[model samples]
Target: MKQNLWINGESVETENYRPLLNPYTGGQIAEVAEAAKEDVIRAIDSAAEAARGMAEMDAHKRADILRKVADYIQEDREECARLIAEESSKPLKAARAEVDRTVMTYTFASEEARRIQGDTIPMDAAPGGEGRIAYTVKEPLGVIAAITPFNFPMNLVAHKVGPAIAAGNTVVLKPASQTPLSAYKIASYFHRAGLPAGALNVVTGSGKNVGDALIADDRVKKVTFTGSPAVGKYIRENAGLKRVTLELGSNSALIVDEGTDLSKVMPRIVTGAFSNQGQVCISIQRIYVYETIAEDFVSQFVEEAGRLKVGDPLDEETDVAAMISAEDVERAQSWISDAVGNGAELVLGGESEQQVLKPTVLLNAKPTDKISCEEIFAPVVHINTFMDFDEAITEVNESQFGLQAGVYTNDLQKAFRAASNLHVGGVMINDIPTFRVDHMPYGGVKQSGTGREGIKYAVEEMTELKLVSFKLD
Candidate 1:
């Protein structure tokens, strides 16, 4: 299949291309454009010109386009999901859900675009300011550079691109090098849905090269990125004066409090940790089980984890597919080995079992170790017991990377305190950290990077407040 890069609403193909590998088979899946430096400049120039004129476009026009984008996504649902699964190695079931999320994000952003209201000051009503009126209106931050990660390619693209476009800002997306095909298709779909030629552009190339070129360009007015903390900081330093929204890194921790039924909690935890091969930013990495029920929870979790089917993603019976590649599996195995070498117990599956890591579970794991501290981005959970709720919350919040977290507790007070004390973005009261419904404030605290995603919050972030003060003459 031929893959065309989308730029300025055109299906442009570069003379040069690079190989795309099938993670399950370790073979070339497709070839993508090694976009020329000149083409990159044209894309930047086009998006910048779009941004220049967008401030004058009516909000209703932008909303209408986003509505069209949503309709197109649903109309081409199956094909989009298939492409997502094929290119990103996401399980067929999971890929279908991602398509649904993509649709939801666009739809929500469309509705929210019409509701991007600003604040009105009461100066005119006040005695001393009878003739004066002051109010604030949100304006687009000009050109936005959307850099999405490999996992949930289409959905993340929707989260960034939908809000940027709905807020009347032109976008240039630099999708993950490993999984740009799905994103390229999204950009195409948006263009066909009647987005202006220069309003949205998609480029596929090296993270260090294309990403740097986009960030360093003065014309790009905003940068929205989702990646590792190391790269996020690098972008922040290099991207000067532009508005930045960084969604980076997550060693998401979950606390299973006492009094919750093990049967109910274990399955959710396993599915949350293993779904999408644990490539999700909010995937469960560390489990701080209450000491009272720690052993029982571990046993129940292990039993459930054993039943997860690890094999081909397209098969209806397959529960877990391959991890992006054999190399990622090896890296996960090495981390487990290093952890086990330091006395961590390998409970269920271990080593590279031909791209399927078999849902490994560790017991008595260390927090300082890579399995717990680092963003493994794999379906592996580290086990650790905590004495009480305070200790549990403390241990879970210790990591520098705080994205989303979960706690299973019947106590409302405990849940509320956990929400307040947990050093993360969103807290799940009775569910796993992986839970996301496409419209909540979705970003992280600390090394997990700055800024908020989700339709409404992202629209708010995509906009700039312009305070207009006027006096009646």
Candidate 2:
């Protein structure tokens, strides 16, 4: 298939094109237009010009369009899932779930469009405003630049694009070069749903070229990104005075406290650590198990991790698939080797074949080890023993990333204590850190990210509050 940039409600192609490869098979699946700096400029100009029209549109009309797009996605759910799996090497089941979540994201955006309310303030209470009525109205921040990542291509794009449209802002989307097909498909859905011309633009190309052009442009009012912290910091530094929401990387942790049921928690831990080849921002990378039950937990976790079937992503029963590329596999394997060289024990699997790496588990990995300190972004996890609950919390907080952490405990007091003490954005009491619905306030703190990305919360970031005051006679 030939995929081109979607700009101003049209498929525009340049002479330059790039091949889209299937990560699992190492075969060319399609070709997409490589957007030039000029193309990005045109997209930004179009979005800026169309912003007023989108802002003036009735809320219900915007909601209707979003709802219709959601319907279109549902109608073509299988094809969407297939495309995602083919391009990203995500397992079929997980690809389908990502599509479902994308649908939910748009649906939630539809609902939030109508509920974007502001507050009315009684100015008579203020000493200087005795006869004045003051209130605020939320207005769209003109144009938005949405930069998405490869993992969860459909849903992550939806998290940014859906809310920007719902908030009446025109968008210039810069999808990951590895997975631009999904972004093109989503843009087509918007077109079929009758979005006005120039309201949504998709530009796919090199991040330094297309992404930087979008970020440095004056017409783009806000920039939302999901990627590594390095790129996020660059955007923040260069995007002077523009509204920015960054969803960056993380090395998430989970604490297995004493008295927790091993059987119930083992399955979830395995799934959380291995899903999507553990490419998720909140994927479980560190496990701090209590000394009393650490041995039992590690034994059960290894057994479960060993059972995961790894093969082609298209297979329905495949539990693990290829990484985004061969380089990813090499990076993950290198990290595992480094940890083992540094005295960490490889408890289960640490094998790789081409672009696929088996789920790996490590024990006695020090806090200074790369697998324990950095965002692994692979199907590997480190397990360490903590003598006390406070020590577990301290270990979880030692990382620079404060994205999300989980605790598997039945004790209410301990759960609350961890919730209060853990220096993370989110705390799951009895669930894994990977548990995220479409409508929750999701983002991270510190190096992980700067803003929340749930539908309503994203809308808040994509808009600005305008205060209006009237003097009473």
Candidate 3:
């Protein structure tokens, strides 16, 4: 298979190409066009030039285009899922879900396109505004640069590109080199959906080459990135005056409060921890169980985790597949070993075959261990017991990440307390932190990230507010 760069609404070949390998098999699935800095600059220029047409386009027309994109994705749902599984190592089931979410993301963006509006200001409330009227309107921010990660390649790209287009902004997107096929396919869908030429471009290559070029260019107006904290921080530092929305790393934690029915939520908990081999930004990495139920929770959790089928991503029964690379597997192994050496007990799994690290669970890991404190980004979760709810909240808040936290408590006061006091962007009352729909305001605080990503919220970010006032002559 060959995947070329999509620039100016056409497939373009490059002199240099990179082999894209399947994470599970390490087989070359496709040869992707490698974008040089020059290619990236071209994409930037195309998007900048296209911005005027996109901004002049009517809102309903933009909405219709998005709806058509959603329909096209729906028509190619299976192929999209297959590409995602082959490229990113997401299990077929999860890949299908991601594709579904991508469809909904575009759908939501379409709905938001028609709904974009600003509030009328009460000009008469001012002392000298007796015969004056004022209101605000949202206008496009011209060209936007989107940098996406390997995990959930289709849906995360949808989260960025859908809203950017809905807000009438042209996009220059640089997808992760490991998973550029999904982005290319999505761009093709947009082209078929009647999106104007150059409204969206996909450049595939090293981040330093493509991403830096996009960030440094003066034509790009906003940069929305989803990836590691280190790279996100670098983009924040170097993006200059361009608006930035970063969705970065997290070690999301879930609390099992006392008297909770463990049977009902155990399945969700396991899925949250092990899904996508724990590559998701909000995958559960830490669990704070109440002391009264810690023993039962650990035992039941281990038993259920053992049932997860770990093998080929294409297998329908496969629940856990390979991580993105062998290096990530090695890093996870080292972190597990460090935690075990620091007095953490490896209860269920601490092994790997190739890039697939078995679902791992740790008990009584120290708060300072890398596995406990950092975003492990592996199928390894550390379990800690807390006697008091406040203690659990404190432990969850101790980390530098403030993405999302979950609490499985039936008590109203406790649930509200967690909602109010947990220093995270979102607090789930009875569900795991990994629960996210396509249209909710989703982003984080602290080291997790900045800005929001739900379609409506992202449109707000991609657009500029202009005040329109009128005075009686």
Could you tell me the lDDT of residue 442 within candidate 3?
Answer: 94
Which pairs of residues clash in candidate 2, taking residues 3 or more apart in a chain or in different chains?
none
Give each model's whole-structure lDDT.
0.85, 0.93, 0.93
TM-score, prediction 1: 0.96
Per-residue error for 185 in candidate 3, Å, reads: 0.3
Candidate 1, lDDT over the whole model: 0.85
Pairing residues by index, what is the TM-score of model 2? 0.99
Candidate with best lDDT: 3
Q: How do the residues 160-190 of candidate 1 rate in per-residue lDDT, one tens digit apiece?
A: 9988988889988889888888887777777
Worst 10 residues of 2 by lDDT: 347-356
TM-score of every model? 0.96, 0.99, 0.99
- Regions of model 2 farther than 4 Å from truth: none
Best to worst by lDDT, what's the order? 3, 2, 1
**Cα deviation of 378, candidate 2, in Å:** 0.4
Off by over 4 Å in 3: none
